[model samples]
Target: MKKRVVITGIGAVTPLGNTMETTWNNVVKGNSGIAPLTRIDSENFQVKVAGEVKNFNPADYIDSKEARRMARFTHFAIAASKMAMNDAGLKVGDNLDGERTGVWIGSGIGGLDEFEEQHKRFLAKGPKRVSPFTIPMFIPDMASGRVSIELGAKGMNNCSVTACASGANSIGDAFRVVQNGITDVMIAGGTEASITEMTIAGFTNMTALSTNPDPTKASRPFDKNRDGFVIAEGAGIMILEELEHARSRGARIYGEIVGYGATGDAYHITTPAPNGEGGQRAMKLALQDANITTQQVDYINAHGTSTYYNDLYETQAIKKVFGDHAYRLAVSSTKSMTGHMLGAAGAVEAIFAILAIKEGMIPPTINYSTADEELDLNYIPNSCKETSVEVAMSNSLGFGGHNATLVFRKFN
Candidate 1:
């Protein structure tokens, strides 16, 4: 028989706040973390705002010398992973079996900022002036590599780089590992620190970024006037452990991870399949995996990127999956506040989903002033909702046509 998996701890370093507690509190309060772009000079670009992590001190989590040598994305991964391990009250080779503890973190564009800087240095001076750690800093898997080393996880150490679905995919894959009895505990989630000139320029050129100068009004997912996603940077980590392992350790459970569904559009590199057909399959698959009917889900954390196609297609997908019951369920896009944390969005949103199940309060989709008739689901517009959330689902759709969904049930 397959083992059961439950989430014991959560950690995040997001634009809304540096720690998971602050981020979740701000999200519940309907506060925006986006601001005028300070990571890069926006004077030359059309986009002027972003959800950038603030007041982060790398030395707070990792050795200052090692932190400097590693990339910013790795810093986030290590910090969030440590926070999660601490919250889970587990230490490899101490409280838990080192060989049974693993790590799987994801990042879409691992360390583009570092690469851009190194490229500039190489161009300005010579290759000799470039840092020797450039390759390690730029690799997407470094986050997982560093975390496994730092935390002494001797089992699987892997990273997924599937664009926006990176985090969700990582968590889902890790879930499989634990469910199959491959490991007792797994550190899973995603991290990204790609806020840089190149990322901005590329996104701006593709018209994938919001050009609204007002940070307050920038990221408006599902709003009729929504323009585009506000690119952001962050990391979200969670501790996924076998239920028996957790119970044996007396670990506090946040929620039980009951289902995961991942799919490929195979339609386009960037554009979503029509009506989000792949997304539909993913949701249906997740429901099937959980052995639950559509009406059982109380809330959905949409992969609402504040983009025209994602919002419309995802809404259509939900409607198709849930039918009339979709009207009864509440669906909200936390990106309205978190501003699309790219690779980290899925994991962070999953954390929000579990929290909703645990706290019975669902975060709102702020700046949802205009309602799109085509997308008429209950967005829980503009304010937090207090209710009994028995089950929550989080969706993540990535640029490479990756679609992932996770289901979290209230722990008994």
Candidate 2:
């Protein structure tokens, strides 16, 4: 028999707030984290808004000297991992066996800020002037490496970089590790700090980012007037432990990770497969893996990126998977407020799904006004909803046609 896996702790540094509790509170109130882009000079760029993490002080979580050596995304990951470890009440080499603990963090684009800076320095000053730590700080897998070192987790340490699905895939991969009895505890999530000038310019040139000047109304997923996603930055980490291991330590359980499904579209580098065929398969596979019927799913945390193609195709995918039941299911995109966190999006949204199960409240898709004719579903728009969600699923569709789904059920 496969071992059951449960989420014992969660930590986040998001545009909504720097911590999980504060972020959840703001989300429940339908707060918008989008604001004027201050991370880069907006005057030179067409995109003017972003969901930037505010009031984040890395020194609060990492030593000043050590923090300086890592990239911003790594800082967010390390901080969130520490917070999750504290929340889980499992200390490596103390309450938990260090050899049985692991870390699997993902980032779609790791340390782009550092890469750009070093590239500039190399161009202006020469390669000899580049920082020696650039390689370690700029790679996508460094977040997991740093977390494992900091936490002293000696088990599996890995990362998944499937664009936006990176975080959800990391969690799903870690869940399987525990479920298969390979590890007792795993720290898994996603992080990204790619809000640099190059990233903004690149996304803007592709017209993948919203050009709306007003931050409050920029990210309106499923709305007819929605333009595109607002690029954002942050990290979200969760502690997943084997069920019996958690119960033995008297750890508080948040939700059970029952199923995970991942598939590749094998069709596009950026756009999703026509009608979301890949996503449909992912959701169906997740349901089959969970051993549940379509009617059993009460809520869906959508991968609504506010893009023209994503929202339409995702709606189609949900309809394809759930059929008539899709209309009855409550679906909302927390990205409507948090903006698109790139690699960190899936993991952060997964936390929202878990929270909905624990708190019995669904976060709203803010800025949703005019409805799109093609997309008709209960988006729980512009306002929070009080509902009892027993089984919730989070969908993450990434570039390169990666589709990942994770199903969470109320831990009975």
Candidate 3:
């Protein structure tokens, strides 16, 4: 028999807030995290706005010297991982088996800030001018490696680098490792910090980012006037444990991870497959994995990036998978509030999914004024709603045609 997997704790470093509680509160209130880009000189950039983590003081999470050695993304990942472990009621010196705990994390473009700075130094001075920490800061796997070293977790350490699908893929892979008896407890999720000159210029050139000046109206996913995703930076981490292990240790159970599905489009580099064939397959696979019917899923946190192609194709995928149930499901893109966290998007949205199951409330898709005729779904526009969600599905589609879906069930 397959071992049961359950989520025991959650943490987040998001644009709206640093902790999960604060972020969820703001999300339910339909608050916007998007704002004018202040970190960089945006005068020349076409996309002048973004969803930035406001007032984040790295000192609060790491030592001054240690903080300087790592990339900002690693700082976020370590901070979030610490919070998650504490939330799960696990102490550093506890009797838990060190070999039973592992770390699995993801990031789309890791340490972009470090790369840009070092490259500038190299050009101005010489190759030797680059910092010794450059290699550790730039690799995507360093996120998980740093977390494991910080916490002394040694069971299984891995990182998934599936573009925007990185987080969900990481979390799902961690769940599988524990479920398959490789580990009893796992620290799983994703983080990203790619808001840099090159990323912005490239995305702007590709016209993949929103140029809307007004922060609140910039990332209006599924809306008729939806333009494009607003680049954001953050991390979301969660604690996953075998059901029996958690229950035996008296751990606080948040929810159960019931299903996970991953696929590739094999169609396009950036755009989703026409009619969302990959997305539909992922959703169907998740439903089958969970042994649940379409109607059983009460909510769907869409990968609605506010891009025209993404929103439309996601809607098409939902219609194809859920059929009549699509109209009845409460689908919302919290990206409307947090913008897009790239690699961390899926993990953060999964946190929302668990919260919806626990609180019996569905977060709204803010700035949803006019609906598109081709895309019609109950998006819970502009306000939160109270409803019991037995099961929830969160989808993430990436630039490399990667499609990932995760299903969470309310813990009884």
Candidate 4:
């Protein structure tokens, strides 16, 4: 028999707030986290706004000396991971079997800030001037490595790097580990802190980022006036445990991860496949994996990146997968408020989906002013809706044609 997997705890360091509770409260309120770009000097860039993690102090979670050695992204991951472990009431050597626990965290552009700083030092001074910890600090997989070390987890330590889908892919991959009985528990999620000069320049030149000066309305997903995605940074982590393991430990169950589907468009490097065929396949595969019909899906946390093609193609994918039932499902983009968190988007959005099931409240896609004729669906616009979301699906599509879908069902 296949083992069952469930989420026991979740933690987030988001642009809206430092903790998951605060972030969720603000998200439900339809508040925007985006503000004037503060991480980098905006005088030289057209993109003047971002969703930066405000008031974060790494010393709160890590030792002052140790925190200085790691990148800001790793700091967020460690803090969120610590919070998640505590929330799960899991102690590495006590309740949790250290040998049966693992960590899998993902990031798209990991430690870009650190890399830029160190490179400048090398260019201006000398190679000797570069920090020795630069390699460990800048690599994308260090988040998982550091989390495993901190938690003393001895099992598989892995990281997924599927651009924007990194977070969802990491969670999905970790879910499979527990489902396959490879491990009893897994700390999984994604983190990113890439709000730097080089990142802004690259995305700006590619025309992938929003140029809207108004921070409040910059990340307007599915809006007719939406131009591009607003770059953001943060981390989201979750504790996934086997159903029996959680039950035996008397852990608080948040939701069950019943299905995961991952696919590749193989069509475009950045833009989605025509008609979102890959995304359609992913959603269909997820529903099939969960053994559910399209009508059973109550909500979809869409991968609406606010980019014209992403919103349009993702909508087409939904319609293709659900057919007429797509119109009935509540689809919303939390990115409207949190901005596009790149690598962290999937994991954070997953938390929102699980929260909807736990709280019976569906979050809204704020800043939805003008509607498009072709993209018609119940977006739950402007305000939160109180409803029972028995089954929620979260989708994440990445730049390199990577598509991942996860289905969470209310634990019985």
- Best candidate per lDDT, number? 2
lDDT of each: 0.94, 0.96, 0.93, 0.95
- Model 2 residue 319 CA deviation (Å) reads 0.5
Taking the candidates one at a time, how many backbone clashes does each contain?
0, 0, 0, 0
Q: Give RMSD to native, each candidate.
A: 0.6, 0.6, 0.8, 0.6
Model 1, stretches more than 4 Å misplaced? none
Q: Per-prediction TM-score, please?
A: 0.99, 0.99, 0.99, 0.99
- From the highest lDDT down, the ranking of the candidates is 2, 4, 1, 3
Question: Model 2 over residues 158-217: C-alpha lDDT tens digits?
Answer: 999999999999999999999999999999999999999999998889899999999988
In candidate 2, stretches whose alpha carbon ends up further than 4 angstroms from where it belongs are: none
How do the residues 211-266 of candidate 4 rate in per-residue lDDT, one tens digit apiece? 99998789889989998999999999999999999999889999999999999999
User: Local error of candidate 1 at 78, Å?
Assistant: 0.8
Name the lDDT of candidate 4: 0.95
